[model samples]
Target: MQNPFSEEQVRQLNEIGKLPPTEQQAKLQAMFSTFNEEQIKFLQNQQKAVQEQGGQCPFCMIVEGKIPSQKIYEDDQVIAVLDINPATRGHTLVMPKKHYALTAQMPDGELAHLFMVVNNLAKHLFETMKAEGTNIFLANGAAAGQRAPHVFVHVIPRYNGDGVNFEWEGKKAEDEELAKIREQILKEGFEIKEEVEEEPEEIIEHEFEMSERIP
Candidate 1:
């Protein structure tokens, strides 16, 4: 499938992949310096897919022992585990117990709780692993680099000068054009409402039954 995230955007991000640490930080700030409404919505939708799956949550399967993972932390509402393919040392994934493909799919309470877990894990990695800092990331869709259709947050430890990088090049836009984009987003935003009611309750019940059967 064609990536929903633009090649231009990726290229801009990849530029950081080539830069020195100080320069990379500057680029990162500049990249997000002008986020428009559409971009925000796109990212929001990207993260919200988790709840749409009716909390027949994939992360729950891993926690329940139906799926295998290098365990990090496990609790009733969340789980933290090592990424099978990590980008940095002590790389961990934080996900909610309920299945959510994207952040937008998550109920506000669940999203808040998920981030709390992520923050706690990041603190542990920084203190226990003795890292300088961390990168907390969420990929909401395939276009945004999400391989699985589950909502997850990546906590990657950053040292003083580690070469691990994710950078890209971006095209500049005129103020007029940016304004038009913002207007369109606001127009659409009015039409967008939380569709939690659409989620199938049966799926939740089935998932709960499966969870009980697991040893």
Candidate 2:
């Protein structure tokens, strides 16, 4: 199959990939804004092709017993295992038996079950490990620091002087902006109604060029 991206674009994409996962999506979105609709579609196809290339997900391997792990809990729908590289002792990762890139891709029942397992595991850690506190974290996407393509929830047991920091710089929002956000979310059906807008004329102008072949 022919490569869809130009050499320069490929280089830019590589650089974007090098950024922290939390920052990568924003940078990629900025870069994507420069591409035409056809280019965007080509990028989407490229993404689908990459996923179809059958790259093994490590979490899936763990579920299949191909990769050894410290299995703490398991059920028909999900499994819980200790993280090899833990932020704290007794840190566990709870994931669905089926592979999913994001929680949003999972069914509501399955997603709920996954978290219920997490809650129980957190309590277990607190009682068994005598943890002072706990942090239940889910990195939903690359933009949220998700390293693996498979989705999982982290349950990290916390203790005094653990030195683990999850803090971020605080930004103050104006009251008007906060009210607008609250109103948007609190609207009927709990859905935010965004105004539909058309793409820029230039972004719609470029045609899809699969290859630079001259007939």
Candidate 3:
């Protein structure tokens, strides 16, 4: 697209961008009022292009209902859905409605709520699907085999000879190395203390009864 903003308008927008979030919207509205019809349309298209680029994550699209999902549970902060390409039967995914690439980026309260949803889904599998055991798995980053950009917890129901393998060859670390690793983790934990104010936990009742087999 051609440059839609003149030098003066560009300067004004830069000033607007630096404003506090609460003030920027009113400033932007006032700025937009001065634009001609064609300039306004061009700005609108540019804004839309930016949104499309930023919101293209598949999980975000699913949350927006732009993409269909076999959703079993949904609330203000989280959603649980059956994994279409499941590891085994009743392999469901629980994720935050907001897009977060890593758990580290999420607020402590939201993270707590997200895992609470995961726990309930696990319980639902055990009760409704008669799952003997379940694995609450999360691959946090690309290095950890995370295929999607959005973070999600996988609730995979376990059975005897289910053929899902999360095994790895066990290696014993030296005592000194293990001690050093533990120390590092403890130090990091101390640095990242929870800061979000704890909200009263709300009881959420969800019905997740479904056929054990997907159609």
lDDT of each model, Cα atoms only?
A: 0.66, 0.74, 0.76
TM-score, prediction 1: 0.59
Alpha carbon deviation, residue 81, candidate 2 (Å): 0.6
Q: What lDDT is reached at residue 147 by model 1?
A: 59
- The CA root-mean-square deviation of candidate 2, after full C-alpha superposition on the true structure, stands at 15.9
- The local lDDT score (0 to 100) that residue 52 gets in candidate 1 is 56
| lDDT for model 2 | 0.74
- Tell me the number of clashing residue pairs for each predicted model: 25, 0, 0
Ten-residue region with minimum lDDT total, candidate 2: 201-210
Model 1 agreement with the true structure over 1-215: per-residue lDDT tens digits: 23445688878867765986445434544565355446545544543453455543456577677779887876566777888778878999988766555565466666776776677778778777899999999876555666555678999998977888866787999999999999987874665433332222222221111122112
- Model 2 Cα lDDT, one tens digit per residue, 13-49: 8898798755665566557636654666666555556
In order of lDDT, best first, we have 3, 2, 1
Candidate 3, residue 143: the lDDT equals 51
Candidate 3 at residue 119, lDDT? 80
Instruction: Tally clashes: model 3.
Output: 0
Prediction 3 TM-score vs. true: 0.67
Look at candidate 1 and tell me the lDDT of residue 72: 80
